[model samples]
Target: MDDLIVKVVVRLAGVYENHGERVYLDAGHRALLGIARAVQDEAERRAGVGGNKVEGPVIKFPLDRAWREKKDRDDA
Candidate 1:
């Protein structure tokens, strides 16, 4: 997979023309764009920010050893 990605990137290397010039994207870039679009659409469909989401300043804490210990203590 790494080799394939490298090969595609190498193929994409070139001196691009100035703006307004009709240029075609490499096969790799086209495929990547398609895949990205598909993934984005799927994510949008599955990820619903409906009435379940609460509006607020959300704070995220790292799950470290100390946090785990506190959680265990609280559970007990």
Candidate 2:
């Protein structure tokens, strides 16, 4: 839909305006990133793809696994 495209463009423009040319590399732009995610979900829904559907292989990892592993190594 035209509106979805417009929303994407507007959100992208906001990212560029706030973070210069390479917006994707800016990890600290949480508000802009959230807006971009919402726009993506909206566009996906409009295209008949469920907004929550995963498009790729899922990788599961424990959040504190790396920290615990490092601590074990240090203790050893």
Candidate 3:
């Protein structure tokens, strides 16, 4: 992607996720997919060698559709 295009994508993604989504404005699925790809690329670049590899048991992102279905679900 072009440098300016990447910058625009990142900025738009940020605004949509942070503010636009909260206001009931729909961020189309295709844009979301693009954002994901862009972010992953940025991460891999910043992480350097083996950055894309996940070797730990840690969960970076939840796979469940409704991890918050129950409020106060966690134990203290």
> Candidate 3, residues 10-68: lDDT per residue as tens digits?
77678777887753235455457667966786688777844456555443554565665
> Which residue pairs in candidate 2 collide?
none
TM-score of each: 0.30, 0.34, 0.29
1-76 per-residue lDDT for model 2 (tens digits): 9998787678767877888776634633754666687688779878989647665655334469889999999999
Task: Judge candidate 1 at residue 23 and give its lDDT.
Answer: 36
Per-residue C-alpha lDDT of model 1 across residues 1-76, encoded as one tens digit per residue: 9998786555555313332223325444665876686566557657863332434644344489988999999999
The clash number for model 3 is 0
Clash list (residue pairs), candidate 3: none
TM-score of 1: 0.30
For model 2 the local lDDT of residue 75 reads 100
Ten-residue region with minimum lDDT total, candidate 3? 22-31
TM accuracy, model 3: 0.29
Worst 10 residues of 1 by lDDT: 15-24
Q: Whole-model lDDT, candidate 3?
A: 0.63
* Every candidate's lDDT: 0.58, 0.70, 0.63
Tell me how far candidate 3 lies from the true structure as C-alpha RMSD in angstroms: 9.4
